[model samples]
Target: MTADDRIAITDLINLHGHLTDRGDFDGLAALFTPGVVYDVSALGGGELTGLEALRAAALALGEANPVAHHVTNIVLRETADGVVHALSKGLGIMADGSAGSVTYEDTLERTPAGWRITHRVVRPRRTPLRG
Candidate 1:
């Protein structure tokens, strides 16, 4: 991917976190394709397809209002299939006075609207086991 592609994809990832944490459901859904697959099963969240389903799932799974989400350390690569693959770290300041983190693995495609995420898998970043 070119430098512009990398920046665009990185911005898209960060925008998702901003919109979701700000409760801008429509804005968040607009960042993905119509049939985007959001797989959060690793966090006990099942796969949700389509914008409507994604919005509903987000509402259901989201913490109460006033949450903060931050995305960082984005790495983007263009796969042989012409898809942009992205990995980033997600940090959250939850409403319940707790903090958490996860790793986001994303597949993004260039769409008419812009570069949008087509599929994403959220996985827990495990700590190294004690020797």
Candidate 2:
């Protein structure tokens, strides 16, 4: 991938946070492939397949969704498999002033429209115990 491709992929990952924070389900769904696989089992959300399923889950959240989503530490890697692997950290600020962090493991591919996430696994970050 070229430098522009890397930039585009980074932008795509960042855009997800913006769309989700705004509750723009339609726009959020467009960020993924039609047959995207979104796994949030770590958060008890179960695995959601396809764009329609993703949209449904987002809409179901309603006002219960986080007020803001901040993504950082986005590391992109291109493998021999022809897919870009993106590992990022996401911090969600809730309406009640509580915040939680998770690691987003994503795989993106180049599509006709642009680079899109084909698969994502949302893993909750555990607090490290002090010895």
Candidate 3:
């Protein structure tokens, strides 16, 4: 891939993180393929597919907790045609009245439309509030 290709992918993913954290479903869905396999299992993320399904999931999550997701350490490698393996670290600030941060690992790719997330597995980086 050319340098431009790499740059494009990086920018696309960063935008996605912004959309997700800001609860911009329309923007988020625009970055995916017709069918997106978006996973946010890191901090209550799961298999959320398609625009409609994912939108609902995002809405629910947004309502439950106000969030701020900052993405970093993005590494992108070409896997195959229209497919790439992207690994990035996401810092999620979840506000359940009170806010706390959690780190997540994400795997995503580029599609015909733009960049679309395939898998996002989150592991907590710090101890959360105990009930």
Number of the top candidate by lDDT? 2
Residue-by-residue lDDT tens digits, candidate 2, 1-131: 88999999999899998887776777865679888999999999999999889778878987778899999999999999779999999999889999899999999998889889999999988796689
- Clashing pairs in model 1, backbone N/Cα/C closer than 3 A: none
The model with the greater TM-score, 1 or 2, is 2
* Candidates by TM-score, descending order: 2, 1, 3
lDDT of 2 at 17: 83
**Global lDDT of each candidate:** 0.83, 0.89, 0.65
lDDT of 1: 0.83
Point out where model 3 deviates above 4 Å: 41-45, 80-82, 96-110, 123-131
TM-score of each: 0.89, 0.92, 0.71
Scored by lDDT, model 3 comes in at 0.65
Task: State each model's C-alpha RMSD to the native.
Answer: 1.9, 1.4, 4.4
Kindly indicate the candidate among 2 and 3 with the higher lDDT: 2
TM-score of 2: 0.92
